[model samples]
Target: MTSGFWQKTGKGLAKTRHFLSAGLGSIFKKKREIDQDTFDRLEALLIGADLGVEVTQVLLADLKASVERKEVGNLETLRDKLKTSLIEILKQVPVAPPIDESPIVTLFVGVNGVGKTTTIGKHAKRLCAEGKKVLLAAADTFRAGAGEQLSIWGQRAGAEVIRFPPGADPSAVVFDATSAAMARKVDHLLIDTAGRLQTKHNLMEELKKMTRVISKQIPNAPHEKILVLDATTGQNALSQAEHFQKAIGLTGIVLTKLDGTGRGGIVVPIVQKFSVPIIEIGVGESPEDLIPFDIENFVGALFEEENP
Candidate 1:
């Protein structure tokens, strides 16, 4: 990421910065001696952000130990300490390397209203910008307008979209798209699936069947499985991921609406527990708004002054 991209990312994280920094800084605004009261207040703020009680406890324990050791005194110092610890946790998500596979296959999974369809368009735009021959597979045949929505994005991104009618077999769509990708020698194939609840057993079976078609049609295809999550969902996002991971394995996570008022702290527990890298984040409506995830910039933005 360039310096300009970092600046854009910092701006995108403004809401989260305000949420965390403002709350943490207020606990020590008076410069009072750091004590259990400080930790208690900090605990409340972190937990309120839906960081998960267990993870929040771990973070608070570390901070409390630092305070007892006289290493952290004022609120400013405590804030820095928390940021350092958070960086350690945030950096644990494995960075997604550049795509090396020709006709690289990526399957997107998520429930409805997480911007899954829009994300596919953004990704297609990115691939097109990179001069990759891209094709979109709209396998979300169950939903009304899902195919048309993807087609509009495909046109906007300058990528061809292969889709079937509503109620059509999604697996057949994947198989057909895979065949087209092979015949056309495309550089990237982005597969979009129907949005389904995590606990819906029949929908899960449908997803698995789509996965089967990809592997069967193309060798080691569907190289990446990314879950599109709405960061605004907070704790519910974690719950959704648990079932999605169980039903259809996830290789990476793409968080949408980070530009909104979402606490954004939820990313912490998701990565800390699932071990899945946050591959991308959508901050705005434009195709260009879905930017690659940069741990350093994200951590820096999370703790920096909101006005910055």
Candidate 2:
């Protein structure tokens, strides 16, 4: 492993731990005996952490059952149970599909101001370093500076970029990009789509059209529809996820801005509710800040010691 991996992974885990502790702190310090009141308090904390109502109830019941079976006796044992339960829930998420072919089309989507373009740029650079010929598509024509911003990042990553004038049809851009990728024989094509507000039906219709357009040119193109989410927004991000998933099926999620604000607990709910594997995470501003998500590393990092 490289220093970049450990550094970024460490930062992400610290943020996760901060949020998790906030949610479960009270119970973690409670007296030895496990009682109904303690269980009820723990349940409320889990729900408040945005663990989702269904998951909260299920975990609470499991914890009570464990206690009845004499499997848990103190906060230390209960904490282990909590972590184990979280990891088990996350284990059900599917892993990322193997990418061996050239010009693997990846479509990026999320609401505006969630760092979608930045994430694509970072990913493109990483892919290039892995000896892949990467291409970028500026499908986000709605935002005033989306194209120029992504184009600049493309340059930094030494990748080709396809763009059209602002106000051009978003789907049309993707259509042309996929066709170009087929001819150029690139290794990966990262397409950045216009960020649509969850409440806008017409905007969402455009996203569906983009998907349809790419699938037309290359069957099963857009092999990945990655939803980039901002961790700072907490539970509101979940509301957005629901709308986006309903609009376009998401294969996985990429969480951005994972360094602070103490709401990393939102990730728990997203996994439990949507079951979308978090394929990548961004903790800092560097290009190498993006790293593949590892559940064990993530759990360790989030609860790791604070830096000096």
Candidate 3:
């Protein structure tokens, strides 16, 4: 990632950082001995930041053990321990396997209004910038204007979009797009599916049908099933993940709108629950704002002090 992007990420996480640091900085400022009251405050701070209950407890337990072992003695030490613990939790989700094959097929999935289409556009823009031949499939046929929205994004990203009439079979759209991708021998084929509530049985079945169609054209295709989630939704995002994961089996996650929420710590629980790598994050609206997830940089940004 570029330094500019890194700076933007830090700036985007300002709310979450402030939410965590304000309490933590005060708790550790004097470097006093660790006590139960200190741990209680820490627990509240973590929970308040939307780390989720289980993850918060695990972190607190680790901190308590470290303190008892005399491993954390000062503000800097405590901060370092916290950062390390978070990184460890995030790293549990193994990195996605390399995409080495041509015409790499990826399905972007999520509930309605999670910025799934926008994320596809940003990703397409990134791939196009690398001079790769890219094709976008507008299989989101249920929503009126869904195809048009993907088309707009495809145009902006300098990629071709394959679509059918709204209300057409989304599976048909996927099949044709898969065939076109193979015929054109493009470097990437990104399919955009309708945003359906995870609880919607027929809609979810349609998603599975689309997947089957792609596989018929290209074996083991739809190489990546990515879930785009809104960071601002906090714990609700977890329910979406649970239902979607059971429905389609997520290969990756894209956390969007981090800049709009102080509950960025929600990323930890999502990863812990699903063990799916967070492939990208959106900190702003610009196409360039979608950046790859880097554990070290993310943790650093969370603890990075604000400029005086």
Candidate 4:
């Protein structure tokens, strides 16, 4: 990533950085030594930052073990140990493979208002900018104006959209979109499905049916099933991941609206729990803001001081 992108990531994570610093700086400002009080404060701070109880416990456990072994003696060492632990958890997710297949079909799934459609637009823009012929499948017929919204984004990205009337069966839309993509021989086909709550069984089954339809049309297609999550939703995002992963396996995740939340630590728990690679994150409103997830840059941004 360029330094510009790194700077933007750091800027996007400003709230999270301040949240961490405010909590941690006070604990370590006096060059506090490894002690029970320090550990307790760290545990509370991490959990408050939305790292989730299990992840917080594991991190603290590792830090305590390190201290017991005399590997960590002061505040700086404690910070380094925590940062290393986070990176290790993030590294558990394997890198996503290259899109070798033409008309690479990718399904975007999530609950309503998670920026699922917006993420698709940003992704389409990225692909179009790469000089690839991109097509969008507006398979979200149930939501009012969902097709129109996708059509607007399709225009913005200079990609063709395949949509049907509202209330039409979503699976039918996917089926037709698959046919169009195959006939047009586009480089990428990005599908936008209706954002149904994870708990809705009927809607989830519809999603599965659409998956089957795409697979039948093109073997091993819909090559990517990405779950779009709202970072502001915190632990609720975890619940959605659990249900969606069970309903239809997820190949990747797109974490959006990080700039709006101080609980960006939620990223650590999501990866630790699901082991799904975070493909991209929505740092800002523009299409250019949906940057690819980089482990080192993310960790660095979390701890780096604000630019003067």
lDDT values of the candidates? 0.86, 0.81, 0.90, 0.90
* Model 3 ranges off by over 4 Å: 28-31
lDDT computed for candidate 1: 0.86
Tens-place lDDT digits, model 1, residues 77-159: 77788888888988877776776777889999998889999999999998898898999999999889999999999999899
Please give each candidate's TM-score: 0.96, 0.91, 0.96, 0.97
RMSD of each: 1.5, 2.4, 1.5, 1.3
Clashes found in each candidate (C-alpha, N, C closer than 3 A)? 0, 4, 0, 0
* Model with the higher TM-score, candidate 1 or 4: 4
Stronger candidate by TM-score (3 vs 4): 4
**What is the Cα-based TM-score of model 4?**
0.97
Candidate 3, 147-181: lDDT as tens digits: 99889999988999999998899889999999999
Tens-digit lDDT track of model 2 for 1-308? 56667677876657556655654556656565889888888877776555667778878888889999999877667777777777888798877668666678999999888889999999988888888899999998888989999999999999999999999988889988998999999988899988778889998888889999988887877888999998887788888889888988998899888875455656778887888888888887788778888776666565553442
Clashing pairs in 2: 13-301, 13-302, 103-186, 103-187
* Top candidate (TM-score): 4
What is the TM-score ranking, best to worst? 4, 3, 1, 2
Decoy 3 TM-score against native: 0.96
The global Cα lDDT (0 to 1) of model 2 is 0.81
Candidate 3 lowest-lDDT run of ten: 299-308
